[model samples]
Target: MTITATRSTELDQHRELNADETAVKSVRARIAEAGVEYVYYQIVTLTGRVVGKVVPARHLPRNIEHGIQAHPGVVADLQVDGSGAMLAGSPERGECVVLPDLDSFGVLPWDTRTGFFFCRMYEPDHAPGDDGGRPVPIDARGNLRRVHAGFTARTGLEMRSGIEPEVTWEVPGLSTEHVPGTPHTMYHLEHMERLRPVYQKVIEYGRALGLDMIEGNCEDPGQLELNWMFDHADRTADRLILHRQICRRVAREAGATVSFMPKPADDRFGNGCHHNISLWDGERNVFVDPDVPGLHLTQTGKDALGGILTHAAASTAVMGPTVNSYKRYLHTGQFAPLEINWGMDNKTCAVRMPANGRLEIKSPDSMVNPYLSHAVLLAAVEDGLTQGIDPGLPRTTGTGVPSPFGSLPLTLKDALDLFAVDQAVARGLGSELADLFLRLKTREWERFCASVTDWERRMYGAEGC
Candidate 1:
């Protein structure tokens, strides 16, 4: 399996290519067998994967370049963090393989111009391994399963989740963030007009990706949301990963860069990856008890909420994992809550009891690996349950914004450091996973840290000199 050129023919170079080709062929055959006509997939280094279905069209016939692409990395403005920082120097650009995920094949109920494979970025020669192989570290699906099984075993409760994404999309080069030529409110109609074809393409893409998605417009103009049907926590997280990719791709073909940047523009509002998660003790809601006086939430439910809040600061790394993530929590001296307080009907708190039974957190944004983020989040909830933590009556003594509850980290480095100190993170995620994450994130942070900022240079050139 070790196939360096310096190595033996036991590791044939041609064999790897053949193996990858076979894998691709096998998957393509599976899609055919499944009666699927379109397929799509995306590849990114870390993890979070889903495959989408697309309808093949005469015009968009299989792209001549049908693989994970690399063309000298010449797109000079490639921003790694999506935070507007640019990387310099041409990194070695090589072809990364993108094989379709046949397991994700499905026929589109709508338009059929494109099909998709939830693609995998694989080593060219890497064949599908033994029937079962160790998971890639970034695989949120695997990570969530590991944690989900652990939590259910201990509490006899499993979680189910659904999402309501609040997003705004426009044709490319129309960004208010980078270019501020027009009123933000007026851009939606134009966005919608251009988005029509993209919407049809999305329907085609969703089927290939195996997403049970339904799309709709939201209260905002270009504002749109896609509802991914409910699934167990582990699986739902995986779908979100794929969902993000699908939405972006369809948007791009229609000439838009789908952004999940927490706050793309300072003057405008940011988006929230609102999670509606509930625990089920074998299909029955655990938090559903209509009565008040110590009966509103089962002790188990309260424990989970308490664990999340008490450890809220520590969990900030996962919940609000990026610098931009904190931007949504504006501290403009208004009623908006940047702190960690929770209450029913209180959007003011980090954790809000939206209604009678459901608990919601607006802290997490789309940039997160939904599965990994969910796992860490669940771990926090699990910790509270185990410790029998009490959320203590939601500051219900009739309070004014429940006294600000500090805030999440302002930068990736800050979040990484906070995660390092969280004992619950270590306990829930396991040392190997936690340590590996720290090391990886630290490297990413250093990369950002060492880079020279255009802002710093422009602002300080003459003054500093």
Candidate 2:
């Protein structure tokens, strides 16, 4: 995905730290053991800076409920400035806050803090304009909330999601490319050995943290998938984010680097995070059609699929947000969709309905922000519904459309240029964030453009320098 050059900002790098002891006692127990001095969360703005920070601990003393209703200025602090630097504001730099998200608290395996709670930052009523407000625009979590609200408001249909993230293993001595396509290695054996223990731990952590969590090892070598037990949309996305960090931390301790990059290697398979989303109406599965032959998706499913396919090109900047992500699109006549079309059970189509209610978008890989990307997907779906687009004649195979989808930006330069004029996308992401996202991504593109790679140096020799 690309951004215009006008929007870069600085960011912080410090790792955020938050601890809670659900097993031993509560937030109180963790504090007694490790000193409940403060809780930390990673702050990313729709626009502006994205950083890691510790938030005000005033809520810690006030009680758990107050912690959930954190103030807006502090929530504004959640977003990093345009530079990607971490924030060290006075409220965030010092003091312990009692974080109480029963659904969010978990002891990350690698970090081993015993208790970590992903929180909702809030500002005091007297602190700013829009009393008791939060950085509403920056809240990716809020986007999910609205999505859930949209579903409920429309059809009493609620949605739950399970994110499938794949990875290629890499070590200090070996490149990630070497491991994924290694013909000599046992099938998916390496990732399994490392992930099983973490899976068990996630189960335990899920119980304590009130997370609906289930861990599964997929068929891909060195790749793993985590499924949160079905819940409301907000909880699903939250668990997915925090769970990913937990997986990364645990894997690091196992002497491996795990990345959600769209394509980690050219020789071997690439990694993509396929999200499994199901809608439930009360206790009934709204997506399932048992009697209607071959699990034919209902009309609603088709519309949702249409939303994804129609917006695939425009959504590429966010869905396939990273440069490495495009590599996954190079389909080798194998399983995996690179094109922006939809077919029934077609893995090659960007959007697929494995069944009538099972809506799957294959384009979202490991690189982009899950929360943000999912929001965009919902926005696309919203558009499809509002626009009454029909996903006619389901396809189950790649159509081999040689032409590029609306000329996808091949590099950072291309992305920024396209993003600058993507009015529909800009409206969905909102003005502030759209500007910030464009600016930051644009800056990164320039960083690449202004530099010389070894390939360029070798080809041009001394003249290039």
Candidate 3:
């Protein structure tokens, strides 16, 4: 029941099986009622990719007790460099056990006969810990839980978040033509009608998978942003991953390719995964109504902002996560943050206080792994709280913001460099995870730097100048 910063083996499979007895009975009843034939035992990788195994529902009881086997590399995207060399570790290395989080079991609404459950991974035949079989260090889900537990233990507060995920959909060779006065548009009802079928399916499937689908709207030419009710940080992260899967499934049937790319096109607004966060103590919102001035956020909220802004530059490596991600930040007027300042109800800063109760981090793109994002923030906030970190005054005018402190790292490379050396971030993520993550991302940046791109060709292809 407890997750520590150093070890998570405190949760044993047998212990989970015992604690999940009620969940087992409930899932079994639902399985029989729904006639589910197969169940997928899945886990999210460091890059937020869903990977897992499929087993017949008849074997559910056995799987619940013993779990399934998966290669360790998959937890790190089974990454490869430009030369096809594995980045984190060899694919031929040993495997790990993937155990189901019983409460996460849900029937796939798209196909009622099949069910799914998100899993937490551990080393093969080993109990999770520093001495025992350690939880896979590169496993983002497990790491997030560890960080969340540490935060709760230190502060006795629960973090809650609601995520706004925006993505683009494109059907190959589709024409712009539509009925007169029904042109493609942003926030127009007619355009919503045009995309309704696709998103409707997404919403339906999302709700079935426990998304609590609240609403959605068209943002760009082919972009849509959907929202869901907020919950504990861990559950919200799981739902975000499931939301991506649901969107992809819905888009596939419509014969369209879906992209969570931060900047899918040069001329339009990029897709962003904005996180709205608040903290709770029992039933009360601790981030609100302390009668603080300016944004009216409590001292605790300000401390959290201080921690987030302090770690903003280093954290961008995960929040943005790719070369193209920085492109979205570089553009002006796209509502992307180019600086690390926090502001009152302003979308231009990296951390925005949109209301008195919570803070919205604007830097995370659609590609972010919610687990990592939340974990890093938890670490930063914990640091702020323990050290009594101050967030400084909110920037009322964009021009009045000071230089250097106000800016974030300009590129993935810069972000990685900062992440590698930051003691606070390293301690937050655990040295083992922080080192492996740096290796994975450094490999990505290296690959991008070595590749010759269309931009290079366009600028250099003219006859020798």
Candidate 4:
């Protein structure tokens, strides 16, 4: 008797793409047209960092077929645990293959000779058992793609989102200090003028790289929130990653440093990347209630909101991934959401209806990993939809009335504890990714707890003691 190996879902998808000779030819033609000499095969890490190899354009076809091999540890950013053991896997672990999504090919506007493609990782074909050519479980970007696809197939609803990326640029002459008699710089035209060159370069690169430049304004002395049009959740995540890359390049050119830190200082406004999301069923918006006047949500929308609120605390581990990220929540009156409630156009609520059909989640800070954030959100929303979770009444006032859904976690440690127990949120990231994310973040929290800050010295040193 003859036996054959079973094909994994990832291997099936990979095999299906192998037949797309037209797409391969089109990418090659575009590269030739642009006079591109080098191409980057980039993969997003667990922490949302982009890492990959650059190859000469001539090898594009060979690369597309064979793909690139990299250590699986790259997905974890190659981070180590408390004992200095690799958090992802051992050095002896077999390499994974990164295959490009040809549709994502784009040439760098700054460096016309070079182009790049966002890739998905899979276990190498030579891997043992059914794992061969399977999607790497820790591949956050790939996971989001599969998650969204599954959600849409099950519910016939697509999640569309736009991210308001607020970044602080440390320029030579810019100051965050408040002048005693002068008005605040929020939305001030003069402050924007000062950084015109920087924003202009950023917007230019963003548009060239496929972002539909919508609007932007100076939010604080050195903080700016530039926005682009909303799109499918997966595309929006990719755009957010590209936006960060663009800002980094523009900052280098302008001799300024860009900070995506949630809270750079106690007094300064926290840098937030608010996700404005809506659910769509074909051409119709499922979140909008056409029969009701003023601000109202459809049953589907409310259920989704309820699901998100229920899981918000647990999901915070991904939204606010660092120790400093929690500081944004502790700082009072900084526009960061403290409660799990949702209200009409309420900035103080974690989930708020910024528009008739959209909900803006403010808990996600600038440092969030979009892939992980969206995955958790999709899972939570699906739970709400399937279980018919009720969101209850919306809070009309900004007062600290306790939400039945509870408060957002005040620290990374607390958030991780919640994340560890919430199987629903963990399901969104899959078991493998959830475990790795928890390990990496837990290590981060431990490191922060062990280290003494300047505040500690000020409170306990000889001067105070």
TM-score of each: 0.68, 0.73, 0.91, 0.97
Error of model 4, residue 389, in angstroms = 1.0
Order of candidate numbers by TM-score, starting with the best: 4, 3, 2, 1
List ranges where model 4 is wrong by over 4 Å: 1-9, 398-400
| Model 1, span 166-254: residue lDDT tens | 66676654433423564544335565554567556665666566667765543334455667677687667657766676787777567
- Model 3 residue runs over 4 Å out of place are 1-15, 81-85, 126-131, 171-184, 290-295, 462-465
Ranking by lDDT: 4, 3, 1, 2
Query: What is the alpha-carbon lDDT of model 4 when measured against the actual structure?
Result: 0.90
Clashes of 3: 1
Q: Candidate 3 on 252-302: residue-level lDDT in tens?
A: 789888899998777768899988889899889988875556658788888
Candidate 4 lDDT tens digits, 68-149? 8888898888989988889987998988888888888999999989999988988888889877878988999999999999
Q: Which model is ahead, 3 or 4, in terms of lDDT?
A: 4
By lDDT, who's the top model here? Answer: 4
Count of backbone collisions within predicted model 1: 26
Query: Which window of 10 residues has the lowest lDDT sum in candidate 4?
Result: 6-15
